[model samples]
Target: METLFRICFFMAMMRFSAAEELKRNLNGVVGGNVTFPDPVLELGFLLGGRGTIALVNDRKLQIVEEIYTNKLNWNRNSGLFTITDLQKNDSGVYKVDSKKARVFYISYNLTVYDGAPTPAVETLTVSSDSCWLLCSVDKATSLLWYKDQEVQNQNSSASSLPITVHKEDRDSSYRCVAANPAENKTLHVNVRTACGFNETESGDNPKQRAYWSVIPAAIALIIGALVVWRVKRRLSEKRQTEDYAEVQINNENPQDGTFATSAESSDHFDSTVYSKLKLPEVTSAEPDLQATPT
Candidate 1:
């Protein structure tokens, strides 16, 4: 009967010890630091399952693992343990055990991840009234779109998400966030600039609208002036060629019967001139011949 009582007492003590242990979830980033909230009072810090990494006994700190030689630190006053330059493989269950067993045991499930990349915002389409935007990130755990400070949309398992913004809200702020459990990155955006619109929110003002229109108007005038100048130059050259041909035709001697000019050439000139010559009469030719015979 005494042996049965001893077994019952031992089982009760084991149940009490197991009930005192608590667990928590924590996250960390690669190359970054994390502090375990468990305050150390002569405690042993172990990694994974029963692998001692650090210990604080008799007010002296001892680092047992070679990997955590300089990376782990213990604060006596604050009684906190910190690890720096975390790696992805460092993610696991971390246990802190009290030497005297007076304090409850606490274990942390630490998850370490690489740094999150900043999301890129793309303008898909824009009209006079609204703009369509898309946000993209690589290997992100989640993507979020924010208008000002409020989240407008989010996707947990997708690499990209889309949002529609109205032109009336063009003056408001916008951003995209790519995040994992351990890290997050944000990218700010200006809707007006992203949508390729140069007009301001006060674009309805007549003076301001005209101010923006002046540049394009000036460019159009310059292009028109150049076209007109080129056309006039071509017409002037044609007129000069026609005038030269007329001068050459007028210089020819018409009496030589060498008017080798074509009809096409004469039609080019305004008018043409002609010269006529008459022979003297020879009525008394026969009388001269009779006198010579006598």
Candidate 2:
């Protein structure tokens, strides 16, 4: 009776141990590495098993279906199994058994998926004193907002979420996380001061610098053109005044008339006029006196 009771106790203990399953949930990206850590202690005596037959002191790991032959590797000492270049077909339940008990010991639930899309963040001003940060992604199940790597909002389940930015957060970096069952993606942006948008590290804008530089040059060119025009005008007026003064000086001299002729021609014309007018007056007077005497 005592032997039968001992047998029943052993079976019950085995059933209890088998009912306690060690479940591990893990995620793996496509074309990446994933490792299933052994839950058994290093010093624990665990014999490898195959079906109902137990291999005595068998330390070699026995994969159930041999589904992954080329990509799987195992460490006997640590009882760790690693798979490289993970594919979608690798997603499923992986079981490790204890050889001494011929029962499953550890089970790993792995999920493999393609990478998630990176989120895009933008800033908008709702009012003069209020601002909103918008985060967006394609096919995202949820959205999270972060300030300086610290989580600000985590309850968002939409692809897009809007967060209000405060005055104190202007100098802090804002981040957005877009997540799904496959993976998580993040993007960040630096916020500016309360008065304006974020400036470059040098505290200057290239376009503004270019505009300022061009302004001075344009003003200088305009001033130079004005100075050149004034100089030309002054020179022209001075030349006109000099010509007028020369004309006035010439007019002040009495010998500088327009119709004045040469001296020799005037004297010859006066002598001819006097000879014609004197005629034979003297000869006539002498003849009258001689007839009276006869």
Q: What is the lDDT of residue 289 in candidate 1?
A: 40
Q: Each candidate's TM vs. the true structure? A: 0.62, 0.55
Error of 1 at 267 (Å): 54
lDDT of 1 by residue, 1-294 (tens): 999999999998887677555679999999999998877765555455548888888767888888898889888887788889999888888977665655456789999988987788898988877889999877656889888888999988678899998887877889988988888899998987887555545555566777778989999999999999999999989777656432124335655544343332334576654332333545555454445554
List ranges where model 2 is wrong by over 4 Å.
1-22, 29-32, 39-66, 75-79, 84-93, 97-104, 111-114, 122-131, 165-170, 180-182, 190-206, 209-221, 244-294
**What Cα-based lDDT does every candidate model obtain?**
0.78, 0.62
Candidate 2, residue 108: lDDT: 66
Query: What TM-score, to 2 decimals, does candidate 2 have?
Result: 0.55
**lDDT of model 1, residue 211:** 76
For residues 198-278, what per-residue lDDT tens digits would candidate 2 score against the true structure? 333224456667777899999999999999999999998966654431112223334433322222223223342221111
Clashes of 1: 0
Clashes of each: 0, 2
